[model samples]
Target: MDDKELIHQILQSNNGIIEARQASEAGINNKTLQRLHQSGDLERIEHGIYIDPNYIEDIYYITQLRCKQGIFSHETALYFHELTNRTPFQLQLTIPSGYNTRLIKDKERFRFFYIKKDLFEIGKINMVSPFGNPIRIYDKERTICDVLKKKDQLDADLVSSAIKQYIKEPGNDFSKLLTYAELFKIKDIVRQYLEVII
Candidate 1:
């Protein structure tokens, strides 16, 4: 009925997380948020993000909130899509070329890839983070294409495993995989791997 109740409702609906922008949009001002934070009712996790003290932080979702343009990709996407069993050591995020990644704090926690703006959104999809928060990531086909494109820089076994698992996935779309491979200029390489695996 009031600002505090509205804030609690927002937090409850958003997995106990709330962004200042979201609160503002709900007609609760910054002053109210600050008051709540001062009273220990909310914890400030990032610059403009807050959460209930009892809530476990979803690093993936929090990172996405901090870097709105970032989409989990490469090995991170593979792990999320169940194409790989290995968990990534660092979060892999892709953003449009020329985006200022320097603005992202804790740079060491992530491995960022830059892509042409035109191709940035290709195969982007919503996936639930391990913490059950919604996060943006690349679909399986796009992730396979991306990993193949960077095969030289990634672990050979990891790449091989991901490709093998992807090929065996019942939901995989080979047409989309090849289409994305063509766009990444790795069509021939993709076919070579597919031929070997399939």
Candidate 2:
């Protein structure tokens, strides 16, 4: 019905966040947002992002929405999956090179690197609820393959350890590695590594 009412529905629908333009499409005017902020009904997470602070408290949802197809990977993804115990130096998200995205929310250790799209596979695994919704994580197979392909960020020890751990599983989906490898250009270094491992 009105801006505040529409915003209320958006908050409940999108876990407390919505793209700014959506407000307008729903009949919310800029003046309404200004009024809401004045009344402390909303807060800006970024230029075009806003949230009802109470409904959407977690910052990662905003970050995740920004990345879209991006899944936290490498050390960051590994830490989240509990596949490794390493402390991450930053929040790393693998995206296509030339990937344009909103400037990341201010914080420490925010890392964004471009990976070939083919490397994006190691898909979602069932993860425990975040803010009470069942979440899925980037699967281990895809993560390890991307790490191996990148190789720089993942230290020799960590890479080797992760590989060994991943390989040990009967359902590890090792073939997913090969299938995803076909997505890349088959560079000599990556191909050589895959040949040795798979």
Candidate 2 on 3-121: residue-level lDDT in tens?
Answer: 67888998798777767788878877777877777788888776667878787465445666556655567777777656678867776776666667764544464667676565444
Q: Model 1, 62-174: lDDT tens per residue?
A: 88888889999998998998878887888989999988755355666888899999999999999888888889999999999999889888788898998998888797799
| Candidate 1: regions farther than 4 A off | 102-105
Per-residue lDDT for 43 in model 1?
A: 96
Identify the leading candidate in terms of TM-score: 1
Cα deviation at 97, candidate 1, in Å, is 0.4
lDDT by candidate, in order shown: 0.89, 0.66
Residue 126, model 1: lDDT of: 93
Deviation from native of the Cα of residue 126 in model 1, angstroms:
1.5
Model 1 lowest lDDT segment of ten: 100-109
Q: How far is candidate 1 from the true structure (C-alpha RMSD, Å)?
A: 1.6
